[model samples]
Target: MRCHPLLPAWRAAARCLGALALLGAAVVARGQGVGAGVGGEAEIAAVGAQVQQLARDSAGRAGLRDARIEVEVGQLDPRLKLAPCQRIEPYLPPGLPVWGRTRIGLKCTQGPKPWNVTLPVTVHVYARSLVTQAALAAGTTLAPEHFTEAEVDLAAAPGLPIGQPGLAVGRTLARPLAAGSALRAADLKARQFFAAGETVRVVAGGPGWQVVTEAEAMNPGLEGQTVRVRTESGRLLQGRPVGDRQVEVML
Candidate 1:
């Protein structure tokens, strides 16, 4: 396959995968003869290939080039019958990412009965990530020894898994996690820097300029989370918590 000059490596690879899927569909459709519905197995396999490629491309784009990826393509509903098609296209449904349990789209382009259906899919992305060494209860402040690194499926649950010791250390768990479970950002509690009605420093800065003021936090200021504040003049604004009782707003 030739790479497009305008496309990145992952995009070029995606194009190649799409072309291969089309070619595979054509070959299988021919074997089924003209005016016959594409074989369900063949169609499912094509969708599976596309989904696997998508997960790999996505991981590559995210700088996980060496990450191990596994894709599981599921069966279509038995109650539904397919249509005769000369061409079938597999696609990722918009807004539905290839993470964990998801679906792949299969549409008949040149079929006697135009039809589209979703095939169940599960994308498992395995990499070195932090996992609890033992069952920990909620509110446990994480320490270096609390968790250890292991190769686990990042998409086995929601939220991005924590890989670095610095990210997991000193953070409190929001919920109890079982031993050997992958630790994710969602598993940690949001750190509260300032409580509601507290006067917090607000810093707004732009190129070559910086402004600092104090405002009353309308809501609790949680680390890396947005907090609503009212300035001295009662001007309401939103900013992200950067530090203890500190908020930053980009102008």
Candidate 2:
């Protein structure tokens, strides 16, 4: 018979089947172990409590309310030694929708060795409101017409300690300012006016004169002449010596 060839083929088939069986058994055992470890309700609850405390602490620091929070628990692993607070998500309060998300993680001491755990969490806060107030008129107080827009500064609102300056909330003006509106400090036009005791170059018909005056004025002097100056009632005497600032006029 042809038994030689058939024997080798049978042995190969048997070896393959045995290897598959071992692999299957190992897979099943590993799955069961994981399921059992996760099934410990008491340990999961304890870990959940720790996560809740972390959430509370973070919310307090952020000036958020506890009621506006939601917490979810994940399976605890023996390898996990760190806080999983990052997994928590807080609920938003009424009259407010989700604005943004913030993540936080912490670590607690369980024993000598530390385990790295992560908590995937989310925090929800109220949507900011916008309110605008415009500057009051000189004689009139603030009225509805004074405000042009309404908005709030969201970043500064959160995490504010009590008695600290609260968030700056307001709206922006929509339209251009009315004509003839009262001028603010920023609106005033700066004019450079001549001051007393300042030196000024005087140009007349001839030579340029440099005049240092104790008073403020554009003194009438000739271009190319030097003048002796005397001040009477903030005015320069016309008939004076020739110099830079003052010029002598021939009478």
Candidate 3:
């Protein structure tokens, strides 16, 4: 029999959906097995709630009070049957930050068979921050018009987000960024006051005394960064870049 042109496509999609449903059922069955032994489903659910509260507390301690925090606790592995735990202690793994994707360790302290397991968790910390208004290329000097404020998940990426437009304005981008992407402090290039081999004024100030002298910069003088400069006497001194072609040296 002849079939409709779209019939095969529809059949293929139906088969995919059926396979997905079967896979979902298998996962549910496996999850049921996980809680069948020691603590059971109710205890497992309680543990997840406790872990979530712990995550929220950690975020608050990290000074994310104004930020919207969301936590997702993963299910335990179904393969290992848990023993009846008289006390299940949930703790943050040592040296693991509570931000981003992290794990919470659960140990059976007073059980016949002591068991330790970790549940994966995803932490979302959302805050209002500046983001690119349009796709920007590397070396593009940032301006107020180039950014817009949006709610961004800070834990999704490293580096702190630039909150004020003035903080990022006049800075060049270090790399290309997609439109609507969060603007981070690390995304801007270090402010270059003077390049290496350039002449700069070295300002030295002491109690009731100030000395200004010219020196040759041995390396690029970036804002807030220290650079070595050779004075007229050929003595090398470390100074921080303060302005264009200027370095500040402490007495």
Candidate 4:
């Protein structure tokens, strides 16, 4: 028996409805995908704007009145199995433009991947011109020597006792000393007498007689006189004097 002609029309209508339903589903899926991509881009742009605003605020606080600035955001990693908006670009300070391609690692919720997304931006400022003009008008230049290290010698001469001016070795003497005469070191000598706030003594002269100390007292004793020296054991011994309060005793 032959099938009814109305059955063929019903079958055709069913096939058409199935195709239309699939087409509608595909259109809806494509729209959703496009919306998601656009949302991600909008989020990145919003982040970039926020970062730019912060940079502007900081520059204002830093006394930079005429600085131009910008901010960019992009993915740090692409192979990361995270959300599309998980990565972000870093904030770059205003400076001279860097030429050529450069890569920098960014911190993101996405897994680590180098140079996945990058942004290049240019910032120009009029402050540099003002600075250059000011430097030129001042007629000055900074040099490395301006920041160099310095040294001072504390052990050198002219480092004298407190409240006492240092006397030159050959100057300030009451009697002339011969050029080749040897003097004992100041620490090894002993004081024979004390007068006028100074120690007057005889220093070792070599074999025959003792040399007089060079220290000058305010009240000097007569030359070629005799003085009494009290030994460490409290014995008073007569000593022949030479100059100032200096004296020589028999060894």
Instruction: Give the number of the best model, judged by lDDT.
Output: 1
Query: Residue 86 lDDT in model 2?
Result: 21
Candidate 2 lDDT for residue 204: 30
The regions of model 4 sitting more than 4 angstroms off are 1-39, 74-104, 108-251
Best by TM-score: 1
Name every residue pair that clashes in candidate 4.
none
> What are the runs in model 2 whose C-alpha is more than 4 Å off?
1-100, 131-251
Estimate the lDDT of model 4.
0.32
- Model 3 has an lDDT value of 0.67
TM-scores for every predicted model: 0.76, 0.21, 0.63, 0.24
TM-score of 4: 0.24
Order of candidate numbers by lDDT, starting with the best = 1, 3, 4, 2
Q: When superposed on Cα atoms, how far off is each prediction in RMSD?
A: 6.2, 30.6, 14.8, 36.2
For residue 221, what is the lDDT in candidate 2?
A: 41
Per-residue lDDT tens digits for candidate 3, residues 156-248, read 777657777777889999999999999887888889999999999999897899999999999999876889999999999998999899999
As for lDDT, the candidate ahead, 3 or 4, is: 3
Q: Residue 82 CA error for candidate 1 (Å)?
A: 2.2
Count: clashes, candidate 4: 0
Better candidate number, 1 or 3, judged by TM-score: 1
